[model samples]
Target: MTYTIRQAVAADLPLLADIERAAGALFADANIGEVDVDDVAELRLIESVARAGGVFVAVKDDAPVGFILAAPLDIHIHIYELSVHPAHGRQGLGRRLVDAVCDDASARGFKAVTLSTFRDVPWNAPFYASCGFRILDPAEWTPAFYLAHYHEADMGLPLERRCFMRKELK
Candidate 1:
């Protein structure tokens, strides 16, 4: 199936939560960490991101099957979330959504794209690496990265299995 990537509109916001839940369910099967089905982007947050022009969706038959959420950080685009329904998984939709964010950031003259993900999850760090992101060494971490780790820790994520990565746009 061919999926098209585009900026998300207000009407598309509600569907994104469903996509997030479905996508996150995949983690439950991974048997790692707590998988909270309700841990999804709230409508308010999605609306805010949409308004900021930072949300993009992968649409199939005019419905969102996947989406990527990002925003400008101090010097790069920070991808807060990326999700593709498990039913639609392994189709490169995730990669395409990631590429869209990277392309958008590059066009806006951002230095790079950054994100945090599970280091041991094949679809997390390894997938991002395949997309040209490199795991940032501890010495390469910035203040923002430290804060990100703090936030992740506060959320009960396994920090030891988490790592920050960056994909330079230039």
Candidate 2:
């Protein structure tokens, strides 16, 4: 199936939330952490991201099947989230979204793209590694990373299983 990758729009926010819910459901089968089916980007947040040109979506047959939310942080493009409906999983949607973001970031002078994911999840850190991302050592973390870690800890996420990754765009 062919999918089109484009900047997300205000009207696409609701569909993005649906896609996120479907994607998050996959983690429930993983049996790790609390899988909140409602754990999704809020409409206003998605609107703001769309307005800032920081959100991208994958559309299949005119329906959104995935989305990637990103922001500029620590002089790099930080992917806040990337979720695709499970029905569309393993079809390279994630990589396509990441590549589009990375290309945009590189053209905008960002040195790298960074994100955090489960350390052992086959489709998390390992999948990112296959896409040219490498695990970032704790000693090499930026100040923003420090704060992000603190926030994640406070949220009661599995910090021990979290792995920060970076893909240098140069």
Candidate 3:
């Protein structure tokens, strides 16, 4: 049950992508239309985050079971991706990853953490709600956050099913 949270390294990019694939499978039965397991995180992006210390991995038994990637977008820390292998689900790895990102954001003087997820997915929006993220009103959205809705829609993810959420850092 013990896991270590540490900055991701060069060797973890592929493993993180693998974990992303396994975690994305959980959406298969959510009836969210489709599950694109092949759309895992790209190695270059992962490597960039890893090099910049914006990525963290939950390691158990010397293997990465989960990872979270964050980036500074405008005035906030945007959680670009968070994925935990299905086998590690419900073990709090995801929350821990979010906390890790939040800590880094605080260190960087960011005011909030932001992310987007499917509102109807049991483990997506609801889980984030439990973590103190509330749905962001359009008026509250930064230009990038506002445009992300259309970007997602253009990518085939219905706008109505997805939403941006924010958690203020205090």
Candidate 4:
């Protein structure tokens, strides 16, 4: 199926919220625990990206099926969020979204792109690793990165750690 990816507009907020909720629900069902979904601060962060970053949504027949959000982080790019509706899973939408973000980062001359994901969850860290991200040591991470992007949701599993991952844009 053909899908279009384009910059999201302000009018897309409600649909984007729905996508967030759906994606959160998927995580919960997978035993990832509840994300701090009602946090207004987090919502505002996403809003900021929607307003400024390379915020792109995947649409099928003009309805949003997924979205990828990225923003500048010093000399690097940080992928704040990327989600595809459960209905569209295994259809390559997620990969396309990440590719779009990476393409933008490279075009903008960013040296690297970074993200964090659950260490043990099959759908979380491993998925990113398959796409060429490697685990980063916390001690080597910058204070600003730890402050801006790290969250408890990245560590929902008791025995599982949250790991930072980075990919060089070269």
State the C-alpha lDDT per candidate: 0.90, 0.88, 0.87, 0.75
Question: All candidates' TM-scores?
Answer: 0.96, 0.95, 0.95, 0.84
Off by over 4 Å in 4: 35-43, 148-160
Model 2 off-target regions past 4 Å?
Answer: none
Q: Number of the top candidate by TM-score?
A: 1
Which residue runs of candidate 3 sit more than 4 Å off their true CA positions?
Answer: none
Give the per-residue lDDT of model 2 (tens digit) for 31-98: 57787889677888877766657899889988889989988878888998999999998899999999
Q: Specify the poorest-scoring 10-residue window by lDDT in model 2.
A: 44-53
Candidate 3 backbone collisions, by pair? none
Give model 4's TM-score versus the native structure. 0.84
- State how far residue 146 of model 4 sits from its true place (Å): 2.7
Task: Determine the C-alpha RMSD for candidate 1 after optimal superposition of all C-alphas.
Answer: 1.0
Whole-structure CA lDDT of model 2: 0.88
Q: Candidate 1 on 35-85: residue-level lDDT in tens?
A: 898889889988887777789999999999999999977688999999999
Candidate 4, 124-169: lDDT as tens digits: 7898888788888767788866665444434443425577788887
Candidate No. with top lDDT: 1
Query: Over the stretch 11-110, how does candidate 3's per-residue lDDT look in tens digits?
Result: 7778887899999888889887776898987888888777767899999987999999998777888888999998988899999999999888888888
In model 2, state the lDDT of residue 130.
92
Q: Return whichever of 3 and 4 wins on TM-score.
A: 3
